[model samples]
Target: MYYNCGVGGYISGIAKDKKTKLTTAMATIGGAGLDWHDVKSYLRPNGLLSYSTLNDGSNKLIFNNYPGGKVFDAVVLQDNSQGPIHPELKKFFEKYAAIHSKDIRATGAEPVFLMTWAYADRPEMTKQLADATIKVANDNKAMVIPVGLAFANALKDRPDLKMTVADNRHPTAAGSYLEGAVIYAALTHSSPEGANFLGGCEKPLAQKDAQFLQSIAWKTVKDFYGWK
Candidate 1:
């Protein structure tokens, strides 16, 4: 289960196409301003691991409408970009995260939190969001993907990289690719440094740039988890 906004959509796009160590079957339900509250509405009434589709013509990827009573191994939860950091929304973010973590555990699936990046223009948000996300994940004893940390590391290493669209919030192709790579590294506990998936970017990334993003992703994940 992958649920959130455009970031989750882009990650699902990579999972749908990328050939990695893990064979993934992802169901992505996304829309703008999608928070945990919105996710709660879509939870299966039967208390299954599946969710009803919220197809408002905004979702980039929608797969496996019904899990057919099949349980998911893990469910990725991403709140709105500001949900973790915003004062008013942060409470709901924490509350629903706890609720959903327990709900997901009840379904025999681990709850994984997707730590999203801050808006491109607001670089300071990186640490703020990371802190908030880590707190919640620690509270639930859940896994944190650390995608936000990957984004911050990428920008710090290469300030010239165009990570976001003109809106400075939505990710560009390169940014999306980085997100996927970080996720891959975190989930598989392996480096994505040499995998040849370009994340379906409109224009293929240069080999050098792709490798750079992959390295950054692997490094970030390794550091976040204190992995060797």
Candidate 2:
């Protein structure tokens, strides 16, 4: 039931808490750039709560749209300058988890899992970031949802599905949907009808898009759990 307390509020209204059966525990990544202040606003006055990636670093990375470095081989800054594996990033996610934990506990709901999706320029860098990111999540014993692999897979076939106008790295509306699909699948433990639901959710992406997304998503999930 945790959320990013930003655009994630939009996802609050999908279907009453029948499946999850609980009010959401919201969390914002970096606690910045949120369109709304709290779950109430993010979910809108009328929307019921489900889940969304309002504040995870992966989503923040997507929002920042930081390009991958040529030498680093990753999109996000993972060097010592950024304090790779330092307390700052850990603290950021820690504070995030603490807040959501408090919120969920107060609401008497059991914490489920956490979702993240980052866009890096290369596979090697993505693995590095994923390693560090996974460490942080595992240290806290929270389920970490991998959305990057999903994004990468979603684009395998649809080479035209660029997230940014020039970079093809940041997530576009379609990319966001791909992220949502991954998170949705994790929370529900059931796959959606389509891998990447585009066209205002009325029509699924072409078969190529679905396969591409599915390909990466499956791999990401596999890596997350060491399914291989």
Candidate 3:
């Protein structure tokens, strides 16, 4: 099974980009519960499958929401935090280990990947999040992906590259393209095809023509999944 889950606010951006048509069927499907633990009983009996989501926040937020649940895998994340790892976060993961230990003893094996996506406030901040993420992942034996750092590397040379700033933080059209690449990278563990996706949005300076950003956007997703 393929389970998609995340906080409502984070998934809204993806729905807007991937299925802009608000009335479409997809608008309602393909996401997991924001608080996975809260819905554990509903998910446990379902069995093994692929999972994805932007379920990032305080560990307590996750713990309170999820109690003794297991995922085949996960990409836990939090938005921008300018400082070093928040003390609360460290505490939460420690507690997560305790809860997970109990769950693992009962349930066998499950994989977890701790992730974070946020623009760093300064150059050194990336290192801080990296170190913190590594430490937590080590303690919990979870995979770690520092998406914000990855974006910084991807965009370093392309100064023109920028996230679409709608209400200031949410991705714009171009921003969504960047986000797609990030997600692609997270899934594939590779430098995903980034430029190809952005090409669809270029404004035609000449003849009267039509362009559809969604086509490129969707292709990016398809190609990343090796579906086309």
Candidate 4:
């Protein structure tokens, strides 16, 4: 199950680049503006199979009322863009993350957190979100996909790249591509440097840009986990 806000959908196309077989049963409304608390409500014990279709800006799949008795290898969880760092919402983020982790474990699946980036104009939000997410992930013994760190790293290297749209919160196609790369690395522990998925951008990403993002994503993941 991919429980998300907006960015989680991008993983489908990116996963395809790495030749990762990913089948997502997404629980979200319109694919945006949802917090961890809202996700917990949708995943209540009695409504485990209740999910909506997911349009990852590439493919759209409808899995509502997904067939019962199915098991997933991992479930990715992403909170609202600011839930992890906002003063008022931080507590709820921690609380629901723990709750969701326990519930996901009970189903015998690993719970992976998708660490999100900050608003485009707020560069500092990257570290704040990462710190909060890492703390909770450690507490729950869950894995964290460090997309936020990758975003910061990429911007630090190439400040010219536009990672967000006009709203400064939602991801642009390039940002989404970077996210997909990070998720691929985190899940497989392999570099996405040579994969061919250019993402679902209206105009496919230039090979050089894609390669750069892939490199940044892999490096950030390795650094975050201290992997050689």
The candidate that achieves the highest lDDT relative to the unseen native structure? 4
Each prediction's total of clashing residue pairs, residues at least 3 apart in sequence or on different chains, is: 0, 12, 7, 0
Question: Deviation in angstroms for 81 in model 4?
Answer: 1.2
lDDT of 3 by residue, 1-228 (tens): 011122222223333444332211011222222222422332352432222333565333211232355442333333234223556455554455445534543444443333443442345555666676666557766555444454445346444545324333334444444444445344444444312222123321111100122233334345433553
Q: For candidate 3, give the lDDT of residue 128.
A: 69
For 1-228, candidate 4 gives per-residue lDDT tens digits of 121233445566666766778755566543343342454444543455444446577556554543343356687888778887778877877887888887777666788988999888888898898898899889889999999999889989988988888989877778888887888788878888887767663546888898899899999999999999
- 2 or 3: which has the higher lDDT? 2
What lDDT does each candidate get?
Answer: 0.72, 0.42, 0.38, 0.75
Of candidates 2 and 1, the better by lDDT: 1
> Which pairs in model 4 have colliding backbones?
none
Which is the leading candidate under TM-score?
Answer: 4
User: Order the candidates by TM-score, highest first — what do you get?
Assistant: 4, 1, 2, 3
Ranking the candidates on lDDT from highest down gives: 4, 1, 2, 3
Model 1 scores worst on lDDT over the 10 consecutive residues at 1-10
User: 53, model 1: CA deviation in Å?
Assistant: 17
Residue 148 in model 1: lDDT: 89
What's the true lDDT of residue 63 in model 1?
43
Model 4, runs deviating above 4 Å: 1-10, 30-70, 201-203
